[model samples]
Target: MYKTSTKIHLYTVRSQMRPALLLSMTLFSLLMLSSCKKGSPGSVNDPGTEPQPVADAAFLQVSTSELNTMAIDNKNVLWFAGDNRGAVSGLGNKNKNVSFVRVADQVKSVSVSDSRSMIIKSDNSVWTSGDNGFGELGIGNAVSNGNFVKVADEAEQIEAGWENGFIIKPDHSLWASGFNHYQIFNSSYSLADVVDTYQKIADNVQAISVGQAHVLMLKTDGSLWVCGQNVNGQLGTGNNTEQRGFVKIMDGVKAIEACSYHSLIIKTDNSLWATGHNEYGELGIGNNTDQNRFVKVMDNVSALAGGRFFSMAIKNDGTLWASGYNNQTFGITGPDQNKFIKVADNVTAVAASEYHSMMIKSDKTLWATGSNTYGEIGAGSERSLSVFTKVKLK
Candidate 1:
C-alpha cells in the first residue's frame, strides 16, 4: 500500500509541472504577438505622415538674392531690395532667382510699401552686416563681411545712416547701431555701447527714424520722441541743445523719415514738418537757415522720403514735390528751382538713394534720377540724370 501511494504522488507532481510549462509558453507567445503588431505595417508604426507646416511659413515662400531690404505688403507679398537691385514676389519656397523680378539693381537705399522696412548701404560698408568699420555697422565695432549677415533678431523694420543702423523691434522697441557721436544712445551713449535705447523707452513705438546722428521715434499714441546729436536742431525741440535722452518732439505724428542730417515728419492732418541741417535747404522751410523747431513744408502731403541731403514728398493728388540739394552733381535736376517744387504727377511710391531718387507710378512703372555713376538709376548709363526718367524693367 505504501509503494502504491508513492508512485501516485510522483505522477501527480509530474502532471502539475507539465501544465505550468504550458502556461509559461502561452504567455511568451502572447508577448511576442503584441510586439509584432506594434511594429506591423498596418499598425501605428507607419512612417508616412506629412510634416506640419511652419506657423510663419509665408516668409519662406519667396526667394530673394542678396536681400538687403524686405517689406511685406497689405497682400502679404514680399518686396525686397538687393545691394544694387530689388525684387517683388509672392511668398513661397521657390528658389528661382528668375522669378524674383528685379525692380532696381543699382539701389543704395530702400524702404517698404507700408513704411515698415528700410535698408541702406553707404561708404562701401553694408550696414546690415554689423561691420563697424568707422562705426558704420552700428554694432559698436568695425567688422567686415564677405556676405550679408543678419545682426539682429525680431526686427520689424530697419533704417541706415552714414555709419549707423536703426531698427524697430517686433515688441515696438527701438534699436540703433553705427555711430553715437552725439549721445544718440541716450545718457549712456558711448562708442563702446551696444545696448539699444528702444529697450528702455518704457513704451511701445509705432515707427522710428535715424538721421546722421539724431534719432526719432513715433509712439503708438501719435507722440513723437527724439534723441541723440541735436547740434543741427534735428530733434525739433525748439532749442539747439543736444538731446542725450528721449524727449517729446511733437504730437499727432503719423510717419517720420530721416535723411543725412535732417528729419521729416508727417502729421495726422496730412501736413509735412521738417527740421535740422538746412545748409542745403533740406528742411524745405523756404530758407537754408537752420531751424530748431518743426516747420511746415506743405499741407495735404501723403507720403515722404528723405535722401542723404534732400527730400521728396507726394501730395494726396498724386503730385510729387522735392527739396534740398538738387545740384547737377547730386542728380536732382527736374526743375531749375532748389526749394520744394513739384516734380511729377500720378506717382505711387518714392525711394531715395544717397544722391539719387526712384519712383513707381500708379501703373507699376518705375522712374529714377540723380547720380547714376554705378547705373544705380537703371537708366542704362553712368550719366548723372537730373529729371525723372522712366526705367525699363522688362
Candidate 2:
C-alpha cells in the first residue's frame, strides 16, 4: 500500500514496487471485507473449520493488493477499507481477519486503490471513499474524505488508478480524474497537479487497465490505446517517449492487463503479447530486455494479469501459469524468472500484488500465497505462505 505520506514503501519480499496495482483489471481491488464477526475480529484460521460457502457464478469477481484484499461474494458483498483507519485500510486491526457487509441492492461492482475506493451500482451511480488529496474521488472538492461519497451517476465500469480514477460511461466514452501522469486523462501532462472532477477523454471505449505510471484502453473495435510514462516503453509505441495523448498501440486485441511498468494483451487469436519493463522478465518473452513494441509472449491464453514485475495467465485448460521476479507468489524459483511456469490447476481467476497472490478455484473458494504483511493474502493464518493455501472466508 502507498503510504499516505509522499513516500512509497518497497516490499523486498517480492522484489518489486507495491502499487495499489493489479487485482484491478476490469474487476476490482481496493475492496474490503464487507462483514466481519460482530465482536472483535478474530484470526482467520485455515482448514478443517467451516466449509467455505459456494461462490456464486455472478459473484466470482475478486481483486487484491496493497493492504486491503476483497471480493464480491455469492451474496454480492465483501470487504471494505478505512473501517480501521490504519495505514493500509481495513478492519483496522492488522491481526484480525476480514468480514463482509451487505451492500445496497443493485450494487454492481467496486474498485479500489491505495487510499480510495469507488463503487458503481446498477444505476451506474458512482460513489467514492478515501484520500481526495488530489480529488481522485471526484467528490467536487480536494478535501480528503474517508467515507463514501456520491460522485458521478452514469452507466458502465470504473477503475482506480495509482492515484486517480478511470470511468467508462454508458455511451462507451471514457472519463477520468486525479494524478494526470503524462496526460493519460487526455490533456496537458502534469505530475504536479490533478483533475479534481471527472473529465471525458474519448469514446467507444470497451475497457481500461491503469498501471502505476501508465494506462491501457481497449476500444470497442478491438484496438488498444496507451498513454503516460514510458521510460521503459510500457506503452508499446515502438519508443520510450512519454505519451501525453492516447496513441494506438495495436489492434484485434480482445483483452488487456497493465501493472507498474508493463502490459500484456490477448489478441483475438488468443495469442498473448507484451511490452514495457522486463528487468525481471515479467513479460514472459524469454529475456529481460524491455520492448518498445508489443512482442509475442505466448499463445492459447484465456486471461492474464500483471503485477510489479511478474505476470499470471490462465490457459484454455484452466491451468494457471506465472513468470518473472522469482518469488513464492508464483510457486517457482529464481531460475524460472524468464519463463512461464504452471502454478496451479483448475483455476478460474487470479489476482496479484507486489508480494502476494489470490486465486479463485473451480470450487469457487479463495486461495492465496506470498507475503501476508498487511494480511493482503488473507489466508486466515498470518504467516508468509510459500504455497497457495485455501483461505477460510467467513
Candidate 3:
C-alpha cells in the first residue's frame, strides 16, 4: 500500500558491485553491500573514515529512491542525491559556501540503483546513464554509458530496480526494461530475453513497487498483481512457486511496496497485510515464522517503508512505527523487534534502503538513521548512528 497497515519494501541494491548470479545465492545469508559510485572500494560500513561537513537547512521537499536521498532546499537548490558526498546542485551553486554539481536542468524526478540512474525531465522525457549490462538504461543497447541518454517520452512516473527500469505513461500503461530473470514482463525471461529497450507490459496500472526479484502492481480497479521470484513466498501467491506471469494476489488494495524478499499491502479499508520473507519479523507479525499467504498485520496506517529486513509504518494520527531487524543499525538497544515500536511522530514520509533510512517530518526537516559506511547518513562523518539524527537539507 502507498501507506499500509501492511509492510512495505525497497530492493537491496548491490551498491558498487553488480552480480549476474544474484539469484543463485541464499536469501537469508546474502549480505550484498555493493555501490553505484565509481571511486570507492572501501567497506560500506567502515567507521574510521574522516567526517565531512554537511549542510542542514530547511527543505521544501524531500525524496528517497533506493540508496539515494534528495531534497530541494528552501532556496530551491537541489541537493546531491544523498548517495554521493554531501553536495547540492542546481541554481548553479551560486552560494560559493556550498559545493554543488548540477545534475540536470528542468528535472522532475530521479531514480538510481547501485550502478545506474534515471532522470525524468520536466518535459516528460526519461534519461538514463551508468551500467547497462542488461540494457537497463533503455538506450536500445546493452552497452553502458556514463552520460545520461533519453530513453522514453511522455512518462508519468519512473522506478529503478536492481538492474531494471520501469515507466508509467499517462494512460497508466507500465513499461519495463533490463533484467527479466524472474519474468516481470509476464513472459519467459530467458537468457536470450535481455530487453535493451522499454516495452509495454501492462495497462490500467496506477502504481508499482519493485522488489529484489519481484514486482507489485496496483491497478486503477484496486487489484494487486505480482510477478517474478517467490522463493520465499514474496509474491504472496499462497505458495513458494515462482510466478512467470502477472498473477492477481489480492483486491481492494490501495498501495503496495516491495523490497528484497518481502511486501507490504494497504487496503482501501485502511487495513494492512503482509506476506513473504519474515525470518527477522520483517512482516511485523510478532513472530519469526515465514508466511506463504497474505496475513493481516495492523490498521490505521497511512504510509509505509520496508528496509532490508525491517518495516516502518506511519499512522493516520501522524505517528511512525518500526519493526524487524532492530539493532545498532536502527539505533535501538534491544534485540530484533517482531512487533512495531513507536519511533517518531509528525512524520510525513520515509524511505528505507538496505542499510540506511531517511524520513521527512511534517516540518519538511530530514532525519536519517542507520549504517553510514559511505557517508550516506550525512551525519558529517562515516560513523553509524544509533538514533534518528536530524540531517540538514541545504
lDDT (CA) for every model shown?
Answer: 0.57, 0.72, 0.71
Which candidate number maximizes lDDT? 2
- Using TM-score, rank the candidates from best to worst: 2, 3, 1
Q: Give lDDT tens digits, candidate 1, residues 51-126.
A: 2322221121111111232423323343443333211111222122311123322224443321122343322222
Give lDDT tens digits, candidate 2, residues 1-394.
2212222233333436344443332123112222222111442423344535534333465666565665665555555321223222322232334433233445567766666666776667887766777767776575643446677888588887887888898899998888777766554546577788988888999999988878899999999998888999989999988888788867899999987888889999999888999998889888989888999988999988767888999998999999888567785444547778888999988888676777888888777777776556655445677888776543
RMSD for each of the candidates: 19.0, 16.8, 19.3
What lDDT tens digits, residue by residue, belong to model 3 across residues 1-394?
0211222244575856456445544342233322312113432323444334444565554445434554555555445443431112222221222122335556766655555666667788887666667877777774543556778878887887777889999999999998776677655456358787898989999998887888899999999999888988888998999887788878899989897899998899888889989989989898998888988999999988887888888889888888889754454566788888888889887778776677778887878888766555555556677788887532
Candidate 1: stretches off by over 4 Å:
1-127, 134-145, 151-153, 178-181, 186-202, 328-339
Per-model TM-score versus the true fold: 0.63, 0.79, 0.77
Which candidate has the top score in TM-score?
2
Better by lDDT, candidate 3 or 2: 2
